[model samples]
Target: EDQVTQSPEALRLQEGESSSLNCSYTVSGLRGLFWYRQDPGKGPEFLFTLYSAGEEKEKERLKATLTKKESFLHITAPKPEDSATYLCAVQAGGDSGYSTLTFGKGTMLLVSP
Candidate 1:
């Protein structure tokens, strides 16, 4: 089975504070690692895609890195608008499509000004 688990279900940050969240996964064969950010009442917005070990992608104030068994999302100097749910998913062989992505519940981030 393919699965993804995220740590620290929730986090609170002051304006400009930065931190990293973890995502662990188990897949038959890794295809890609995806990072998404979702605000309340909306679908996830794509952030980064990591395809292999030692690969990384970044956008805005966020960076995502992948390893053999896990991936990390690092936030740098986040602002109030950056407060949202961060999700990590993996694309692997599944019955759904070419490769189905399994997603973690999410890590909720709240930033206060």
Candidate 2:
């Protein structure tokens, strides 16, 4: 079975503090790694997609990097508005277009000004 786990269920950061969250995954024939951000009451918003090891993607204050067994999301000089839950999911090898994503519970980030 495919599985994803995130460390530090919750994080508290000062307005300009930078940090990185860990996402560990175990799956057979990993196809893709995806990063997403979710607000309190809204659905997760897509952030990045990593198809192979050594790949990285970035946007705004966030950067996501992928490896063979895990992914990292680095938040740089985050702002108060960056407070939200960060989710990591994986697409495993199987039926290409019909595979469902397996998501971690997510790490909740709280930024204080």
Candidate 3:
């Protein structure tokens, strides 16, 4: 089984402020880790995919990093439009040649202008 944990269930930041969200996980035979963003009443939008430690990906004001045990999502100079819930999910392989995504609760960020 795979488990994931995210810290600071909610975050409030002023426009232009910078902060980071954390996601820690435990999994067997990890295939990939994924980052996503979701808005109220909407499905999650894909952000990044990290396959190995020391890997990174960026888009707009967001940057994602991965390590052996965890992942971090850094938001730089965010704007009001950036407010959303950030999600972390991991895909792991099982004995039956199947893979499933184990997700964390997510960190909700509110950026104020």
- Could you tell me every candidate's TM-score relative to the true structure? 0.94, 0.95, 0.97
Residue 27 miss distance in model 3 (angstroms): 0.2
Better of 1 and 2 by TM-score: 2
Tens-place lDDT per residue, model 3, 29-106, is 989999999999999999999999999999999999999999999999999999999999999997887888999999
Q: Show the colliding residue pairs in model 2.
A: none
Candidate 1 per-residue lDDT over residues 47-81, each given as its tens digit = 98899999988888988999999999998998999
Q: For model 3, where is the 10-residue window of minimal lDDT?
A: 92-101
Give me the runs in candidate 3 sitting further than 4 Å from their true place: none
RMSD of model 3 against the true structure: 0.6
The lDDT values for all models are 0.91, 0.93, 0.95
What residue runs in model 2 are displaced by over 4 Å at the alpha carbon? 95-97
Candidate 2 residue 11 C-alpha distance from true site, Å: 0.3
Q: What are the clash counts of all predictions, listed in order? A: 0, 0, 0
